[model samples]
Target: MLKKIGIKDPEKQMLKLMESGAVPYRGVKQKDVRNALEERFEPQVLKSMTDEASLAKRYPGVPHEEAAYREMRRLTDELNSSDKGNLVEDWYERMYAQRRAGSSNRPESRQHQKVSAAEWNKNRPASEQIKKDRFIDRVDSVNIGGKEKPALHEIKSTKGKLQERDKEQFEDMMKVAKAERNGVEARGADGRMQKVDQVVYTLTDPRGVAKNEDWIVDQLTKYRNNLSFEVFDAQGKRMMIDARSLKRSKDGELVLPDGIRNRLGLK
Candidate 1:
């Protein structure tokens, strides 16, 4: 019957048909089995199944068909929902602007910071100076001296409250910032060595809950002194006043304060 219907391999078609009907314990319906077989026998789908089977033979431990279906579904969903445009726009608006607007002297609104291995530690003993280079955390922004002192800005956006790892990361960053303030030079994107005068860490919560912000501020305060915090709504509206300035709104949803707004040039 399969050969009459133009199925190229009647024996394999019979195997599939028998497998589809083997689940009688679950009260399988004849129509369901027929639908399944009809889909499996479609020319393109059947060819894909054959290709997957061939690959399974070539590579032992690979599942026959279910794995292919799962991978195909995952790729399809990812392609459908990817935000490549938004990501590009964000990189341009945030990172590119910072890199191009070198130093705070440029009229651009943002600044950039890069940290690399300190220029080949010559003063240290030969054994200490030739240590293997390791990667440290990267700061989102670093503004070196204009109206305000040079500072490192680490921005984190979280849906919920900050985690333990976040606190530990802040501590490690503080060490780097302190070293920079103490005449330690860090290589920037332009390849010039620069030192930071201060450290400013910023945390942004997208959920914008008053309680969440309060808890985060408390946790950070106990962990370290002199950290900045910002909260924004789901729509990206500023929700909390600058914590550094020690101001709080009645409803916990306030625009950026005058000092910070003027410094950041935000409306």
Candidate 2:
């Protein structure tokens, strides 16, 4: 007979939970599991329930349907720490960047003497249409007789006046992810020597807000739960991308790609 480890019968109250089918927590040690059954009241469980019930209460007369964004800023830390959230924000930011890349983000616009770097950086929309400018320069509708294999065999540009900057950012994200996987060193000071494990994209919806593109209102109703997420290096030229991603879950935690993280102004 195999040696029986641990108490064969749990304490009086623990009998029900250990009976079967009651595992929901993560990184739970065996002893912790038994103790959990013994104690009817789990602090983690209570805290979770408390957090849920909090949504019902509201600050009265906050004006403009938002509570000054301060309470939410303080609370979204849980979402910020999740994997699904990271991915959704990334997609949102990339799209936002593409839109901003066009319009007034002209390269030479910063030549004026009076503008401080912070002021310029803060006010600059995604005017740098690197993708549009490059694609326009490189693309030709029909290949001439001397063309090797045609510049590209496929093109999947979106319809509807094609936003420029968002596409660039997404493409840039893919490239940075690929480069880091290939072991190529990126140049810079604080971000230079660091190994990038993941990338975070914070997408804020600036529509209908009093401020001009200053904050992300929120994600679509359906996708909010899986918003704070991430991507990981899978192999030579591929990565593990989660559409509904998060930083951590009931299973494990995730890190963002270093290069892309740096590019997106994340650590």
- Candidate with best TM-score: 1
Compose the digit string of candidate 2's lDDT tens values, residues 168-267.
5434332332332332122222222332222233222211111211111122122232222121111101122233322443455343334534333432
C-alpha-based local distance difference test score of model 2: 0.27
Q: Which stretches of candidate 2 lie over 4 Å from their true place?
A: 1-162, 180-194, 206-241, 244-267
- TM-score for candidate 2, please give it: 0.20
lDDT value, residue 59 of candidate 1: 38
Model 2 — which ten-residue stretch has the worst lDDT? Answer: 148-157
- Cα lDDT over the full model 1: 0.41
Candidate no. 1 TM-score: 0.38
Q: Candidate 1, which ten residues in sequence have the lowest lDDT sum?
A: 79-88
Q: List the residue pairs that clash in candidate 1.
A: none
Against the hidden reference, what TM-scores do the models get?
0.38, 0.20
- Note the Cα lDDT for every prediction shown: 0.41, 0.27
